[model samples]
Target chain A: MHDKTIAEISAGLQGRKFSSVEVTRAFLARISQFNEELNCFITVTEGEAIADARAADERIAHGTAGPLTGIPIGHKDIFCTRSIKTSCGSKMLDNFYSPYDATVVSRLQDSGMVMLGKLNMDEFAMGSSNETSYYGPVRNPWDLTAVPGGSSGGSAAAVAARLVPVSTGTDTGGSIRQPASFCGITGIKPTYGRVSRYGMIAFASSLDQGGPLSRTAEDAAMLLQAMAGFDPRDSTSVDHPVPDYRASLDDGVEGLTIGVPSEFFDQDLDSEIAALLETTIAEYQRQGANVKEVSLPNVGFSVPVYYVVAPAECSSNLSRFDGVRFGHRCEDPDDLLDLYTRSRGEGFGAEVKRRILMGTYALSAGYYDAYYLRAQKVRRLISQDFHNAFEQVDVLVAPTAPSVAFGIGEKTSDPVEMYLSDIFTIAVNLAGIPALSMPVGFVDGKPVGMQLIGNFFSEGRLLNVAHRYQGVTDWHLRCPNGFE
Target chain B: MDLSIEDVKKISALARIEIEQQDIDGYVRDLGGILGLVDQLNSAETDEVTPMAHPMDQVQRLRVDQVTEQDQRELFQSQAPQVEAGLYLVPKVIE
Candidate 1:
């Protein structure tokens, strides 16, 4: 039952082949059997899930159900769940229960999707590896010793291990795509402003965007269709038209002009991954797609520019956790200053505090123009690079990550080394464009993902292209060993 | 430019995160390494480019002055550590 894709399950539910409760129970059982080993879930709402499923069964009987009516999805633990622990994998928020639901959570609930649990992630969505999570590191389902890339490690792992059909994830740098790649599943980060940020717990407000991680593009599109839209609650949420993501999924990539950025294939990329990408592109050619070489020269500067801009925004956004309104607070204090410092110090982990400090320095009086302003201007140049590439090609193809998942604790000590893992996926966020990562094949017995980047608001086209590719390839079909 | 312990101390204080004496050395090293990584951006020429504060080019949205939110102070304060009589409690500031 866990082997079925969301589309298959949706059909089964609508056809009355089985009730939603049966599907939810099978997944809950799988999570119980495997979560102790994978550590993918932070909280499991079993009673609520069963109740939600029972309601969906009634809705189906009345013939008033939507496409995602019975899907069981996991929140990334970053999005607030009303009266539930939306920890965001941070001790700061561990004791915090939001008074209301995040826009994404409510929208999915409205769609009749059952909430399985809150997925684990990097504390405040800061780390490229899942080790920074206060709950503990999430293990890659493929190899227990290796990490499932983060900060959406648990989101990807849950879907990959078949504990759930899909789960939510937010991408700042490579949070969603990298983990999806490592876990050998599909994930998409919609255009900036495509999803509401209200109650999502801002990390870097300008860069963070929520989407879905699923076993296939069809499932991602189904989940994304429900998650994307405008919200008056989030000032940054764009009032753009939400298209039917499944409408064009079967639209073949015949004569499609696919761009291969030269910079993405530079010396820093792993040779084995490059060879695998070349072969994957050749498969597209056989399906009547044209490949063209393009350049995003300014794309290489993305990581450095992102490091400054993201932290600067984080420092400002995190100031709200001052032990007053909500969240963790110190036991006792001599003065206001003591209260503020100790509360935050005890609440945040090393990575979160380091970013806060980095942001503080960047936004300080004299350094503002040098660090923050200059990085923003370079960010413009990176966005322009994407603008130029899109003029010649319908989509740009690149490796989602430089390599397969590394062993846990390998790069935790070195922040820069960890940041480099997101080298390929950062520029897309800087440009505020939509990109999707789909499993291409494997290297060193671990899975690899190739990214499909498109111009702004082009999620449907990207999903269509990936869905067509999934039809031809079976790499995404292979589940991790011992899971079955 | 490497960040000194003094620089880290100042930054930590400004950020409102207390760093004890033992962790200052590690913070100094890691913060210095991070700043060093971002220093590579100095090479990019952005004199002609406009700074993009956000990915989308738009102005802030404004609505009529009618209040849309209800008073959820009691529910919201349920999670706070120190609250009394519908007010958040804090350390004394006045002498």
Candidate 2:
């Protein structure tokens, strides 16, 4: 039961092979057994899960079930779940419970998907690794000592461990894809305005977009089908038609034009990872796809531009937690300033504070033009690079991260080193293009992922490319030693 | 642009996050390092380029200015740290 994909589980439930209660209990039991070691979950709603499972079983009996009915799924802690602790891996919101559900949460719930619980993440979705999480870092199930790549590390870890068939994750930079690559799972970040952001805690609002992490591209497609589409509540939500993502999974790769960015294969990338990417592209070529070397010249400046833009937006977005309305508050205060400062100081973790300060400095009165506005101008150049490349190719392919998972304490001390982990993934977010990371191979017994990027509203094609490659490969099927 | 300890202090205050006096030096080093990396952007020739505020060039969607939410003040207040009657409580602003 634990080995089944979401599509398989949905079929089994409809065929009456097992009740949703039984499947939900199986996952809850697995979570209890392994959670202490991985720390993937921040809150496991056993009671609510059982109740929702029972309701799903009843719906199945009535023959009114959807494709995702009774499918157990996890939500990243960033999404607001009514009356549930939606801690964004921050002490500030550890005691906070939202009065409503995020649009993503309610949409999945309306499909009758059983919610397992909220997964852990980096504090306010700020870090490239789970080490910055207030709940503690999530260990990669592949190797217990290695760090699970983050912000959505818990979601990727849980899915990789088969605690859930699918889970929701948000990627501001590389949060979803990097962790998915580290944990050997499938994760995708749709176009920026493809999904609604209402009730989803803001972090670099311009770059943040929510998507799915699952065991296969097919599973991700099913999950994404339900999560995409416009919501009037979100001012930035794109008013576009959401296509049937699963409908294109079997679309062959014949004559598919793939762009291999020359900048993505620069000296900074590890040799072994580069070789593996070459082999993966070769496989795509064998399937009748034409590969061409393309240039994204301004993409080299992505990391610097991202640091400036993301922190600036984050500084403004995080100002809402000033300890006056909600979130953590100091025990006593001599004055309002003390209440504001002490509460925030005591509440946020180190990395979160660092980003807030960086953002504040960049957006400050004197430095705004040099830092924030200048970065935005460079951001346009980066997007233009992608636009130029897409003119010749249908999609772009690259390595998801520079390398496989690193040790827990490896890059935590040097913040710039930690920021470099997101080098390849950040430019996609900056351009608001759709990108997916799927397991390609392994290095030193750890998993590696290859990223596929497409133009805006091209999620279906990206899924098709990944799904077809998955059909010819078995890397996505390889479970961790202990996990199996 | 190197950050000084004084710059760190001012930035922390502006961001409304308190930094311990002992930690100011660490902030100076770390923030300076990050800014050093970001300074590479100065080399890019961005003349004649428009500063992109967002990925998509869409304007803010407007809805008719009417009440769209029900009264959930009590439910919202339930999560506040301190509340009296129907308002949030904070450190007194006026004497």
Candidate 3:
């Protein structure tokens, strides 16, 4: 029962095979047994989970339950849950629980999904690996020594370990997709404005977007059905009507066009990853997908542009943590400046500090035009490159990461090496397009993921490609060793 | 783009993060490598292209100005390090 897909779980609830309490308890037991070893969860809300599960059972018994009535899902610590600790994996907000639920959490609650607990993440969603988390780094369920890709690393690790059937994750600059790839799970980062960001603590607001991480693409589709919608509180949210994501699972690539960027296969990429990507592309071609070579000439400079833009926004957004309102404050200070300086100094981790400095430099009085303005211009060029490619193809294909998950702490002391891991993913955020990472096959003993990117509002198309591939292969369903 | 230990210290002070002297050299090297790669944007031409700030070009949608939520100050302030009667307490500033 614990290993069944979301669709199968929903069917079981409809058929009265098992009660919601029974299923929720199974997940709770699994979490207790594995969470200490994996360190994927920040807090477990067993009390709330049981109460919600009982309510769901009552609803289903009365024939009033909806699609996700009995399914269990976990929220990334970044999303504000009323009366629950929404730490964002930072010591600053370690005890800060919001008085109201985030719009995404509210929507999921409205849909009757059971809440499991808060998952761990990089502090303020800043790092490429989960090593920067204040609580501690999340261990990959596949290989404990390997990283679980990051910021959303905890969400991916939990789902891959089958602790929870599905979980929510936010991607600012590859947080969702990269971890999903490293942990061998299916996750999507929807286009900007597709999901509201009102109460999901800001980390580069223009780039942050929340989506789902699950064992299969079909489960992601169902989760997205509830998570995607416009809210008045989030001014940037799109008012576009939600589409039925499951409607096109059978829509295989009969005449579909997939763009393979020439620049993505450059010399800087690892040879093993490049070879694995070729096999995945060849699989699509065998499925009748029309694969064509596309060019994104300006893509080579995406890392520089992202570093400038993301840091600049981060410095501004993170300013609210000055110990004036609701987070960590200094023990004692002689002056307000001392309070501000000491609080922030003690609150943030090394990576967060590095970004704040870079951002401050980029947006400084003398360097604004040279750094921020120029980076914005380069961002436009990168977006235009994707637009031109999309004109010739429906979606683009590439390796999710340059290589499989590296060992924990391997690149922590070197920030540049860590930043390069996000090379393939940063451009998608810059272009504000929907992208997903699905497990393709294994490289050595670890899993590798193939990335599929689509034009804005093409989440349905991206899921269709992933779901079709997952139906024919066993990669998405493979569980990590020692997880049972 | 080559950052020195002094530069790292200055940047850390500017960012308001405390670090020991031993860690400064490593930060300088790491930041320099990243800045070195980031400087490539200088050669990439983005002339004649309008910078994109947001993905959609939708006009601003305004809502009527009104309070939609109640002030739960007590519930919210409970998480603060120091709080008073409906206000957050902090160290003295001006002597």
Q: Quote the B-chain TM-score, candidate 3.
A: 0.84
Those runs of model 2 whose alpha carbons end farther than 4 Å from true positions after fitting are: none
Task: Name every residue pair that clashes in candidate 2.
Answer: none
State the displacement of the C-alpha of residue B34, model 2, in Å, after optimal TM-score superposition: 0.8
Question: Which tens-of-lDDT digit does each residue in B1-91 have in candidate 2?
Answer: 8988888989999999999888788788888889988999999999999999878888999999999999999999999999999998888
User: A1-484 in candidate 1: lDDT tens per residue?
Assistant: 9999999999999999999999999999999999999999999999999999999999999999998998798999999999889898999988887889999999999999999999999999999879999999999999999999999999999999999999999999989999999999999999999999988999999999999999999999999999999999999999999999999899988899999999999887899999989998998899899999999989889999999999999999999999888888888787999999999999999999999999999999899999999999999999999999999999999999999999999998889899999999999999999999999989998999999999999999999999999998898889999997
Clashing pairs in 1: none
lDDT of 1 at A445: 86
**Model 3 lDDT per residue over A377-449, tens place:** 9999899999999999999998899889999989987787899899899999998999999998888778898
Compute each candidate's TM-score over C-alphas: 0.99, 0.99, 0.97
Stretches > 4 Å off in candidate 1: none
- Write model 2 residue lDDT over A232-351, tens digit each, in one string: 999999999999999999998999999999999988789999998999999999999999999999998999999999999999999999887789998988899999999999999888
The order by descending DockQ is: 1, 2, 3
Cα lDDT of candidate 3 equals 0.89
Q: lDDT of each model, Cα atoms only?
A: 0.94, 0.94, 0.89
Number of the top DockQ candidate? 1
